[model samples]
Target: MTTSSSDSTSAAASQPGRFRVGVQKFGSFLSGMIMPNIPALIAWGIVTAVVVNVSEFTEAGWEPTNALAGVIFPMIHYLLPILIAMQGGRLIYETRGAVVGAVAAVGVIVGSDHIIDQFNAALPAGEDQLGYVHMFIGAMLMGPLSAWLMKKLDAVWEGKIKPGFEMLVNMFSAGILGFLLLAVGFFVMAPPINWLMAALGTGVEWLIDNSLLPLTSVLIEPAKVFFLNNAINHGVLTPLGTQQADAQGSSILFLLEANPGPGLGLLLAFSVFGVGAAKATAPGAALIHFVGGIHEVYFPYVLMKPALLLAMVAGGMTGVTTNMLLGVGLQAPAAPGSIIAVYVQSLGGGVGNVVGVTFGWVLSAGVTFAVAAVILLSSRKRDMELGDQFSAAIAKTEAAKGKSSSALASLSAGVPSAAADRIRTIYFACDAGMGSSAMGASVLRNKLSAAGISDVYVTNKAISSLPGDADLVITQQTLTERARPKEPQAIHVSVNNFMNAPEYDEVVELVQQSGDDQAVAAGSEAPASSAEHASGTRTAVEPRVLTQDRIRIRAGSATQEEALREAQEILVSAGAVTGDYLQAMRDREATASTYMGSGLAIPHGTNEAKSSIKSSALSVVRYDGGVDWAGDQVRFVVGIAGVGDEHLQLLARIAELFSDESKVAQLEAAASEAELHALLSGVNDN
Candidate 1:
């Protein structure tokens, strides 16, 4: 939600020690398992809302019954926890651990009590033995602990157990341990754990009854901004709220942390009263945050203006107070805070609850919008400057760190063999496909539209469901590992920030370059001459030397000689020039450094060294980490391994590309070799 880098470990790693990083990674792992199941949680919420609130006709007359509860309650109290435990176990120690994790979770379920005395009150005296244990919390704890314990056991038993008896030993060990843990949970821990939960639930109920629950937003609003909303809601609030729901009819905690009204209000304010790009982006963010139920979309907006935090707190307090005063609370958690999901979850509270939540939503939105508008209007000049600074920061991130190559030889001779045409569809992937990735896709889609680029299709997908034909895959740095293996052939681009505008702009330019290349191929029905290319520099030099494989986009060389040698390797591999050409180039560089202005450094051998060249050729290398060319900081290194006057025309084309700083920046940020080759192919076609 905040504007910090999205790597799961970044916040933890930013702390002063290794302990913090380890804790962060562990927390992130658990979060990964939990966040993907929000849809499942919503379904469970719907079931709870309907089963508890709705009644149907019976044989005698229309009456209420808990029959429908039997169908889904077991899933909430048992199956879901086991599933969560299995997932956590698998994540920690693979299949063996997963099996053991589910077994161990059963112990927690058997020991923990879900209904306790609440069931006695619902039933006639002495006949109230019916009670179910909600094992979600216990399952979360026991699953990982059991997996870790089993892992240790396996390590100790390794090579000791006979090969023939290994399976028997493994199965008996898990079974015995699980039985022992179950006994301990049931005999010694269940009562105390259930008591603690009951106490917490009681505190929440007291707050609601006393009409002091609105004050809880002072803590809840800030926690949500820091990405702790999921942990708070699912781990603490939901379980407590569910226990209360079982006792009474509903719990106010369900609506406390999940009210999307505050975010919706802030976005409405930004859309109406904000200035520049922030204002333009707010309307789309408002739609996503409100109807789509992704409250995260507005967090960065608040973070950008810290004063707007007061607005969020005010909105949250207003919403909670309104719901409390109306005596309305949801039967279950309304995940994602989406309006539709909230309405479904409010079924347990009947018409009053629905009206109350709706009014609260409007009230919070109105308060947040009014407060935020005043903040923006009062600091218009400062807000505009900060907006520009944010954009600049994004641009710097997109430009990464690399030196641009000075090798013209690869561009002319290697001649992008085949990689240019392969990439067409670009995918933006995230942990959950529905939230961040969708917003990223929309951003890029709009950018492409503005650039008048129609052929390229930009879309979003979950990391697991990545498509086969995705020519390029974009994901946050942490989740890139998941997206890469699924589409190994696709060009992978990882960024720390998905919402950064400059990152989207870079991707758009790349797609545009590819489109231009496609147009070039279509218009000519053949590879056009150098003059007919997009950059408008005609060249007589052969295109064979500048193959796709020879063009290195975003190479990480630290110096001029290193860049030149890298370029030489590409040329030699392509059979365009001899390896000894590197030496010849060095001798020429010793005479005078080839540091050209406009972030270009043209490195080449003297005329005398034409004997070392296989033929007249050029190699184009873009270095994102600017290399030191004698005294100049060079970004592009065009390696000239060509012989005689034939290479002169190619130099002209290189000069033309170097002259335009904007185009040079785009080339420097190119995500793949194909994109770079496409840009080169379009050089004179423009």
Candidate 2:
């Protein structure tokens, strides 16, 4: 997992040079023949056998039988190699060692044939006999011989050999080592496999000659009707995995040992005949099919275009048949549905191995390629029409989540598309106008200006003194109270450290969409309360009756008078200077400052008991800013007086908000009433 991207790139760059071009392709084809299911090849191979045996049947189904058989099987033969190369290249990427092993297995088959040919040439002309025993000897042992030889070569190259590809290097490590192993393998295993292959071949020939020829038409006809190649590759085989081996019995063992799906077969076929133009999309498709560990990737591509499907199916069936024909069987399952596990199973020579496997893959790839090419060319128009659907399907994923959100869905003409324009704004507000009021405004203005949005501005003047238009409105909860009815078009932008984050952009997009949706619904519902009557000002959003008897000023313990005085100063510096008006407060204090203990307080006047604030709200101000509290530094303050009992629940949220340690710090250190206001409206309260 600790992969350095640089290293992986370099390694991948050097990978192709390891194998000569065609070797990997031909190797994949030959090795697959020894693995599991191959649908396409079975389709065509059955046809081929039937065609050669047609004259023997009393009824050949007229020329259609011969014509179909001729047309299908031959087509498969031409495209098989393309299918092989594609799948083989993928294997090379994941584990080169396994690939080398598979290629060596191919050599075994070739070596076995080579040995037999040498023997036949040596036989005296008059007595020469091409018999079942001769071929069986060569075929039976070829698989293991190839495997063991590959192992031996790998060993010698690692032990005695060194770097072979660099300039001045021997370059003889695996090659020379393999040649030696090849010689020893041919001597030890070829004779027996040759005889075995010959015997199996003859047996199959006799079956076709005597009984199969007559039934070939009937069997293939029904096969084509109800269960073509896909049924074998996808239908019966893939479902077998949900029933993965759990026990030690032969059934489970077989399930594990055999290749489990036909996914690889289909992918191979796509690569084969999907046309040069289609390959642009095909490589990504093939990789997903190969490594995503899903077999369904290629199904639709094949279904819409059978030529591709046939190429895969033919290669698959051919590989399967050859494996069985060669007596190669899996000991456990492997992905890419290849027979690499047979060595682990040590399931040497059987009724469905070498001959079955080798032949199956060849036929499967070839047939699949042929079918895919035909279907692709036929459906060219349909592909064009449905092209956009593919992108839509992929867009909803995490990989495309940003893509969809970023895509300009319905930008208005010349009205600055989201893609074209990035909107930014800064709101400036202060109560009455002075010290910290100007400080908070200065900080925001400088930050936004540094970001190149100097067009934005913030101010501390009363609404009466201020201009009517602007973009954003940053003010204290109390200041917003004094400033009313201006810049109705401005956005309530959140003031935070990250106007630069991805999430910020996402939030902006959401706000934009929400604005649009709200605009459409605006015709039905009128705007809520205006600035004077703005019920939803930051927090405590509820329909205020604006009834009488709601006190405005918040006070804490008399023991903390010093802390209150400092908080008063901070709030005052921020332009929220208290105007008591004062003497009215002194006259009322004879009764109480509303310091209702347990760290709570409410200070108010007799005359302005119904002191109207925009919100019938709750406020908690800590006097760490300084308060004269009977020598105690009052740590928390709650100013509350509700017109009705309904507003009591609002105190609960206010208490919870004040209880948080982070909120306490911000409240305690507030530079001005307006800074406290901005903090709440921008985040803490929200």
TM-score of each: 0.55, 0.25
Query: Which tens-of-lDDT digit does each residue in 565-629 have in candidate 2?
Result: 33333333333234332223223333223332233343322334334222233334544433443
Instruction: Point to the candidate with the largest lDDT.
Output: 1
**TM-score of predicted model 2?**
0.25
Off by over 4 Å in 2: 1-262, 275-278, 303-328, 335-363, 378-684
Please write out the lDDT profile of model 1 over residues 1-686, one tens digit for every residue: 00123234354544533442343345556665555555666666666666655553234322334665675767677777788787776655556666777887777677665335555567776684745557666666767777778767776765478759967997899888777766665666567666676677678768877878888888889766645455666667876776666556677788888788999999899888887655767787788777877776666566667788899999999999888888777776676678887887787677887899899899998998999899989998886666533232222222111111111111112222123355466777754343345445545555665787655656666676776656777776555545555675665566544443344554565565563555322112322431232223245556664667667766565655468767787777767677667766766565334554577665666545556778755677777777766545777777766553344344444544554578777777789879889888743332
lDDT of each: 0.63, 0.35
Clash totals for all candidate models: 59, 121
Runs off by more than 4 Å, candidate 1? 1-30, 36-43, 52-66, 113-133, 159-161, 385-686
Model 2, residue 486: distance off in Å is 42
